[model samples]
Target: MGEFLMDKVDLDDVLDKFGVFDRYHAVSGIFLVLGMAWNAMWYFNFIFVTEKVEYRCADHLLPNNTSANASTTLWCANPAVCSEWVYDNPDSFVAEFQLACQEWKRTLIGGVQSFGLMLGSFIIGALSDRFGRKTLIVITGVTGAALGLAKSFSTSYWLYFALEFLEAGFGDVTSPLFTLAVEMVATKSRVTYATICNVGFSGGLLVVLIAWLVPYWRHFQRVLYAPGLLFIVYIHVIDESPRWLLSQGKKEEAVHIIRKAANQNKLNIEENLIDMISCEKDEGLSFFTVLGNTLKSKSLLKRFIVCSVCLIACTFASHGLIINSVSLSGNKYTNFALSFGLKLPSSILSGYIIAKFNRRSPLILFFMACAALCIGQPFIPKSKYLLWLLILTYMAGKLTASMCLNTALIYTFELFPTKTRSSMHALCLAISKIGSITATQTPLMMAYWSGLPTAMFGGVALVAGLATLLVPDTGNKNLPNTVCEAEALEYSDRIKK
Candidate 1:
């Protein structure tokens, strides 16, 4: 009888493992597709759509003309140029365009809004932890898709501004989604799965490049909506995290989901495998209680602090570069396109480097090194070869950004307990948003005071370099599975027991 029971236990464990793997594969696949579709804007045309159209108009209108008749005359000369002229001077165009792309001092406001999204995601995170991951994923996905689609039709700047905020807020449901993916997957497979999913954000760059080849912003707007629409189809294939279900006291539901996962992975289960006893916490838990417990934990706190600052530094530097590129750099479109294209190689290289080195070390060294290069940028000779050199330096800054984003995501997930994962991740995002807010002005102010973009990038680089050194490493380990595990920890503590 004992031997027979042991055999059943082994079979159950095998089935359970297979189920987790199946779920990871499916969800990762779906998110990869969505990421490829959506994130390209950062690299592709998101930043330049306004600039491209505006420049086209500027080139045609001969600058400094104010009459509607004059604009109309120009428009008649070339219909495409005419359309660009109208968009160029709309009362709200400058503010709406800057805010939309998060450029200049407006980037500060935009960054704050990003924090607001984190706050929104925080609420979403709690509700997800309480209700079910499936519902929030579906709801947020729909909200984001609707907002993105509606944005294309917006007439006035305010209307577009409102939709832009909604689009940013709703699109970020992915923060919690990342936590959910990490929690639902087996301990060993997480890094690989998360990294692969993250590659989707890079894949988005490829799509954006295609959009850049097009001449019109309206068409680009149409292309931007495609990813959000594609995500709607995922509602059928994905479900709530079983870990969340267990935490919410839905043992039977968790079992059903797990069983389904096994079936999806094509694993065979013995009838007696279902008899194995599992630890399932079905008791309703308080959000305050969970939050307090998570914050007070030492190990989790260390991980959180390091992750937060690194993220902030990275965002400030990389996002600042992206936001200020068109205005600061000499050849706006070409520089922007080259910078965007570099993200692919940066992301690919970051993945490999993180897999090979200490996370914190790379972050610290790169920021400091990049800062020196940036400060010296203004001194570069204004020749073709010199311009290429400046571009290379700019690419270095972008590469650091990619490294920071990747490390923060992987490291934070690994450091926090499964129960508080969403909160921790949200907190990191919130801080990064703050960094972005500060960065919005870094270049503009530097230029105004010093009349040099290179000098500005260098100073920002110094700050980022210092911030990167302050954190510890949390890579290549199991995540904390519970709040208790996160709290009773040290620098080297693993979130998972």
Candidate 2:
């Protein structure tokens, strides 16, 4: 009987027994979406609060403005040596910190947050795999929210900068939460869950637009952190991933959770089904062991490298377009909102495409489209109509890049095994942050030549898109349970081709 059960039981089989979109999953999905949205708010909040609004040298710096032309002279004066800046919004971060002259420092504020995200991905991700997904989510979510709230009360620019770093380090909760969310659902529903998470993220981006209504940046910052309070409720309602539990040799606990899930779904799961579930070994592998094992396998190593490149390219292209889009000649608020809004449909389309087709082709096509648009954006003449066309094309590119990013995200999740999923996801995200860091420099590149930054983004994405073709596809495939299983899938895929 034991041999029969062991031979038959797998995660998918269990998921099939319990309803896939049942009550337990619905509840868990709601919390995960909210958590993911909150994470997105923190990650992208810098874009709004630190925006570069129009400014001019202080009144005192200019000669007595007895003549109307003095106003014009003040605007035309060398902005670098301004003693004090008069901004369109006196309450914005640019005005409060007088950061107009220190444009590079302004850019660093965003870059530093990405640095924090990179660190959090590696450190917190490893901890999630070692401890438990729910534990780290609660810990990071609360701490990150507190730090974000503290940032609203910042007394100095340096203090705010420090808080940004800490907030990002603790607030990078999306990856683990996403992993848990995916693990909770059946294999066929993974794309749906991923797309839902992306939609949540897009919702968060739209939420940031509310900053336009607030009178001050600090007030806006406070609003952004308010959602973090949901983590308290999440701690009570969210369950630990049963897969993670099984991997740790906690079969009884895993069974208990599975039964609870089954009960929640109003399905009658057999006692024998729970008994059948078991782990091969529970030696408690560390993050380095997983990393070492992945690197040792040539097949996984190749896949890892390829996925990393895709991640970087997607990060760079998506964020580069978003940040640079603000500089376009139009209402900054509208453009920003429209750029983010494009994600809603893009995500839906991405989910459908990946479900119907394979991962590699759609990803490659999205990247290529983004590259084409970015490469073509600069060539349009600078008339008002032409500039709007340029903005349209750029936004289109953003949409394509966003699709690639969402697709790459699910693809990366499918590429790794259950044991190392969180850790490997974190590594990919950490490497992607390097692309984000590079993206923050787009403004600097624009100062040299407006087209140079977009061209660079296009060129990088082109290379990454071509490289994606080299990786194996996991469409309609079962999630692997171990490193060896993932390697076997790759080997089998190669043989079939």
- Alpha carbon lDDT of each predicted model: 0.58, 0.82
> Which whole-number lDDT from 0 to 100 does residue 34 have in model 2?
82
11-76: candidate 2 lDDT, tens digit per residue: 677876654456887777778878887787677778888887666666554455345235534445
Off by over 4 Å in 1: 1-30, 39-46, 49-116, 206-219, 268-278, 282-289, 327-334, 365-379, 449-472, 488-497
Q: Which candidate number has the best lDDT? A: 2
Ten contiguous residues minimizing lDDT sum, candidate 2: 65-74
Which candidate has the top score in TM-score?
2
Inter-residue clash pairs, candidate 1: 40-204, 249-282, 297-487, 375-458, 479-495, 479-496, 480-495, 480-496
Residues 292-328 of candidate 1: C-alpha lDDT, one tens digit per residue: 7666766556666767776676666666676666664
Model 1, position 334: C-alpha lDDT score: 62
Return the TM-score for each candidate structure: 0.76, 0.93
